[model samples]
Target: MKYLVMVQGTQADYEGMRGKPSPGSPAWSEAELAAMYAYMGAISNDLSETGELVDAQGLAEPARTRLVTAGEDGKPVITDGPYSETKELMAGYWVLECESLERVTEIAARVTRCPGPEGITDYPVVIRPILDGAGDI
Candidate 1:
């Protein structure tokens, strides 16, 4: 089975990445940031070696996003983001071929433990099975 794992980020998360310290919040030091990247790279390499990694990518800032909807007259309505009050935005995603949903969930759990701002280890990782062929769909 193939699964998609998504990491969520918020505005505060983006600010932290930009070295902007939130009120009473500690900025991520260069070494910490390096360690975070290293950890992610290591895991990706491991998955690749195991032949489970299908694809992985980190997204650009959500501020660059655009939302399109149908207008009253059937025209397009476009809105630029970074939407205020949004709970979270998709920060990155990984597609992995695993034996089962449990395996994917385990991978997601490990990803959530990857180092982040202020040494936090509680990031959310959403996982969903990928429907491939027409029969699966």
Candidate 2:
């Protein structure tokens, strides 16, 4: 089964990673950020070697996002982003082909264990199975 493992964060979290913390989020030092990147990179490399990694990517900040919705007259309504600073958004994801939910869950748990500051790095790691075919639909 293929699964999407999402790492969630808020705009404040992004700011903190860049060494600019908002009210609730703490700043991440340069070394701390590098460690996180290294840890995640190692996981990706391992999965690539094992042929379990389908894709992995980190999204840009929410400020650069474009929000689209249907207008009242059926036209497309586009809103420039920078939504709520504290709103939770998908920061990155890993698409992995694993044998079972248990396997994916284990991997996700490891991802959550990536190094960070001593406190205030506890966010959710979302996982969902990808429906790939007509039968799955």
Candidate 3:
């Protein structure tokens, strides 16, 4: 089965883990930040070695995003960032071709341990099965 591992986090989550300290808080050392990235890379590398990794990439922050919708006359309407009512963002994703959902879930669980800030940092990875093209005309 092919699965999409959606890595969820915000820009704040990225910065906090990468050594940007909040007011009066200590910063993460360069080594710590490097280790975090290294861990993520290692996971990808392992999956690739096993021929399970189809694709993986990190996304630009929401500030660099744009929203497009249809206007009243059906023309394209564009809006700048800070999309309303959204709390979590998809920081990155990994596409893996694996044997089973249980295996994909295991991979996602390991991703949750990929190092983060001091407390309550939301770094969630969800595993979803890809649809196979069957019963099509």
Number of the top-ranking candidate, with lDDT as the measure: 2
- Could you estimate the TM-score for every candidate? 0.88, 0.92, 0.85
On the 0 to 100 scale, the lDDT of residue 26 in model 3 is 36
Summarize candidate 2's per-residue lDDT along 1-137 as a digit string, tens digits: 99999998887788888888766678999999999999999999999998999999999988888989999999999988788654788999999999999999999999989898765558879999999897997
Give, for candidate 2, the lowest lDDT window spanning 10 residues.
Answer: 115-124
* lDDT minimum window of 10 residues, candidate 3: 17-26
Stretches > 4 Å off in candidate 2: none
lDDT of each: 0.82, 0.89, 0.79
* Better structure of 2 and 3 per lDDT: 2
Each prediction's RMSD to truth: 2.1, 1.6, 3.0
Q: Candidate 1: misplaced stretches above 4 Å?
A: 23-26, 119-121, 133-137
In model 1, which range of ten residues has the least summed lDDT? Answer: 115-124
lDDT of 3 by residue, 15-55 (tens): 56556666432366777678778999999999999999999
Q: Which candidate leads the pack in TM-score?
A: 2
The residue pairs in collision within model 2 are: none
Candidate number with the higher TM-score (1 or 2): 2
Error of 3 at 50 (Å): 0.3
